[model samples]
Target: MKIGELSHLTGVSVRSLRHYEKKGLIASVRLPNGYRDYSPLTTETVDTIKLYLNLGLTTEQIAAFLTCVLKNKEAFCAEVLPVYRKKLADIEHQLKQLDQIKTNLIDRINSLQQEEQVKNE
Candidate 1:
C-alpha cells in the first residue's frame, strides 16, 4: 500500500507516518515515480510503534524495540529488558515529581481557602 493508505488504516496522520519513516521506526520503498510503497506488515509495525510511544518510550528506544520485534521473537526482544527497566525508572521518577507538585498545589489551595474564610469573618 501507499503512504496515504497506510495512514488511513493505522489511524495515524500522513505527516506522522512520514516522520516515522524518516526516523527509521518504519520502512518504505520508493517506487520509480518517487511514491512510497509500504508492505502490509507495516500496519502491525506502526501499532507496535504507537504502543511504545504511548508508554513514554522515545523514538530511539522504540527503534531498539522495533529491531527486536522484527526478529523471530514476535514482540519486544528480551535483550532489551534492561533498557525498558531504565525507561520505567525514569517515568517513575517523573511521576514522583508530579506527585510532589500536586501536593504543593493542594496545600496552596487549602491555605487560600483559610485566608478567604478569615477575611469573610
Candidate 2:
C-alpha cells in the first residue's frame, strides 16, 4: 500500500509517518514515481509504535528493541526490560519531586491564610 493508505489504516498523520520513517522506527520503499510504498504489516508496526509512545517511550528507546519484539512476536524483548525499568525509575523520581512541590505550595497557602486571618482580627 501507499503512504496515504498506511496513514488511513493507522490513523496516524502523513507527517508523523514520514517522521517515523526518518527516525528509523518504520521502513518503506520508494516507487519509480517517488511515492512511498509500505507493507501491509506496517500497520501493526505503527500500532506498536503508538503504544510505546503512549507509554512515554521515545522513538529512540522504542527503536532499541522494536525489531526484536516484532521478530519474536513477543510483548517485550529482553533489551526492553532495562528500558522499562529506567523509565519507571525516572517517573518515580519525578513523582517525588512533584510531591515536594505540592507540599511547599500547601505550606505557602496556609501561611497566607493565617496572615489574612490575623489581619482581619
Candidate 3:
C-alpha cells in the first residue's frame, strides 16, 4: 500500500512514519513513479514500534529489540521478558506508595474528626 493507506491503517501520521523510517524502525521503497511503497508486513511492524513507544521504550531500545528479533526470536523474547518484569516491579512499587498515602490520609481524617468531637463536648 501507499503511505496514505498505511497511515490510515496504522493510525500513525505520515510525519511519524517518516521519522520511524529514519530511525530504521520501518522501511519504504520508492516506485518508478517516485511514490513510496510500503510492504504488507509494515503494518505489523509499525504497530509493534508504536506499542514499544507507548510503553516508554526509547528508539535505541526498539532498535535493540528489532536486532534481536532479526538475529534470534528466542533472544527477543528473553529481552522483552526482562523489560516486562521490570515494568511490573515499578508498578508494584508505585502501588505500594499510593496505598501508604491513602492510609495516611485516612488516618489524618479520622484524627481530625475525633478532635472536632472532643471540642464539641
Candidate 4:
C-alpha cells in the first residue's frame, strides 16, 4: 500500500509516519512516481510501534524492541525484559508517590476544617 493508505490503516498521521521512518521504526520504499510503498507486514509493525509508544517507550527503545522481538512477547522477555520491567517499576513508583500525595492532601484538608470549626466556636 501507499503511505496514505498505510496512514489510514494505522491511524497515524503522515508526518508521524515519516518520523517513524526517520527513526528506523518503520520502512518504506520510494516508487518511481515518488510515492512510498509499504509492505503488508508494515500494518502489524505499525500497530506494534504505536502500542509501545503509548506505553511510554521511546522510539529508540521501540526500535530496539522491534529489532529483537517483532511483536513476540516471548522474544521481548528474552531480549529486553529488564527494560520492560523498569518501565513497569517506574510507573508503580509514580503511582505510590501519587497515593502518598493524595493522602497528605486529605489529611491537610481535614486538619484545616477542624481548625476552622474550633476558631468559630
Query: Which candidate ranks first by TM-score, i.e. highest?
Result: 2
Off by over 4 Å in 2: none
Backbone clashes, each candidate: 0, 0, 0, 0
**Root-mean-square deviation of Cα positions for candidate 1 versus the true structure, in angstroms:** 1.8
Which residue pairs overlap in candidate 4's backbone? none
Candidate that would win on lDDT: 2
Model 1 over residues 1-121: C-alpha lDDT tens digits? 9999999999999999999998999889999999999999999999988887887788888786687776657444775687678988998999999999999999999999999999999
lDDT of every predicted structure (CA atoms): 0.87, 0.93, 0.84, 0.87
Sort by TM-score, best first: 2, 1, 4, 3
Model 2 Cα lDDT, one tens digit per residue, 1-121: 9999999999999999999999998899999999999999999999999999998999999999999988985554788889989999999999999999999999999999999999999
* Candidate 4 per-residue C-alpha lDDT over 1-121 given as tens digits, one digit per residue, 9 for 90 to 100: 9988999999999999999999998899999999999999998889988888898988887776686667466464564777788889999999999999999999999999999999999
Pull out the clashing pairs in model 1: none
Shift in Å, residue 66, candidate 1: 1.1
Give a tens-digit lDDT track for model 3, residues 1-121: 8999999999999998988889898898999998889999999888878888898767767876765664566344667777767777888899999999999999999999999999999
Off by over 4 Å in 1: 74-78
Alpha-carbon error at 17 in model 1, in Å?
0.8
